[model samples]
Target: MPAKKPFALRLDEKMMQAVEKWAADEFRSTNGQIEWLIHEALKKAGRLKDTKEGGRMKDEG
Candidate 1:
C-alpha cells in the first residue's frame, strides 16, 4: 500500500448521506468508496497507468 495523506473534504449533507449509504451497500467505508471512485475515474480517463510493480501514475517528463 502507498502512503495516504489526510486532508479536509467538504461535501453537501445530502451527498454525504448518499455516499455513506452507497459505501454500506458495497461493504466499504465512505473513505474507501471515495478512493475507489477516484481510482475508477482516473482509470477511465487514462490517468492511471499500470506498472510492473502495480497500478501507479506514469512519471511526468
Candidate 2:
C-alpha cells in the first residue's frame, strides 16, 4: 500500500452538509467521500494515470 498523507481541509457549512448527506447516501465515510471527490476530479482533469500492468501489485515470495 502507498503511504498516506495528512492534510487540513476547510469547507463551508452548506457544502459540508451536502457532502455529509451524499456520503451517507453512498454508504461511504466522510473522509472516504472527500478522497473519492478528489480522485474523481483529478481523473476528470486528465491528471490521473491509466490503470495498467504497472499499476497492479504482485505478492512477494
Candidate 3:
C-alpha cells in the first residue's frame, strides 16, 4: 500500500450527506470512496501511468 496524504475538502451539507451514504452502501470509508472515484476518472482520461494491463481501453472487437 502507498502512503496517503490528508487534505481538507469543503463540500456543502447535501453533497457530504450523499457521499456519506454512498460510502456506506459501498462498505468503504468516505475517503476511500473519493479516492476510487478520482482514480477512475484519471484512468478514463488516459492520465493513469501504471495500468497493469495495456488493452483495457481497446474496443471489444
Candidate 4:
C-alpha cells in the first residue's frame, strides 16, 4: 500500500451526514468512501495512471 497523508477536512453538517449514510450503505468507512469517490473522479478525469501492479501511480513531475 502507498503511504497516505492525513489532512483536516471541514464539511457542512448536511454533507457530512449524507456522506456517512452513503458510506454505511456501501459498507465502507466514511474516510474510505471519500477516498474512493476521489479516486473514481480522478480516473474519470484521466488523471490517474495505472501501474503494472494494478495500482495507481502518482505523477511526481
- lDDT scores in order: 0.82, 0.82, 0.79, 0.85
Candidate number that wins on lDDT, 3 or 4: 4
Question: What digit string (tens of lDDT, one per residue) describes model 3 on residues 1-61?
Answer: 5698888989999998998899999999999898888877887887867545476643212
The ten-residue window of minimal lDDT in model 1 covers 52-61
Q: What digit string (tens of lDDT, one per residue) describes model 1 on residues 1-61?
A: 5799999999999999999999999999999999888888887887865653345444321
Number of clashing pairs, model 1? Answer: 0
- What is the TM-score of each predicted model, taking all chains together? 0.79, 0.79, 0.73, 0.81
lDDT of 3 at 60: 18
Q: Relative to the unseen true structure, what is the C-alpha lDDT of residue 53 in candidate 4, on a scale of 0 to 100?
A: 44
Model 3 compared with the native: what TM-score? Answer: 0.73
lDDT order, best first, reads 4, 2, 1, 3
- Pairs that collide in candidate 4 are none
Cα lDDT for residue 23, candidate 2? 100
Stretches off by above 4 angstroms in model 2 are 54-61
Clash number by candidate, in order? 0, 0, 0, 0
Against the hidden true structure, what lDDT does model 3 obtain?
0.79
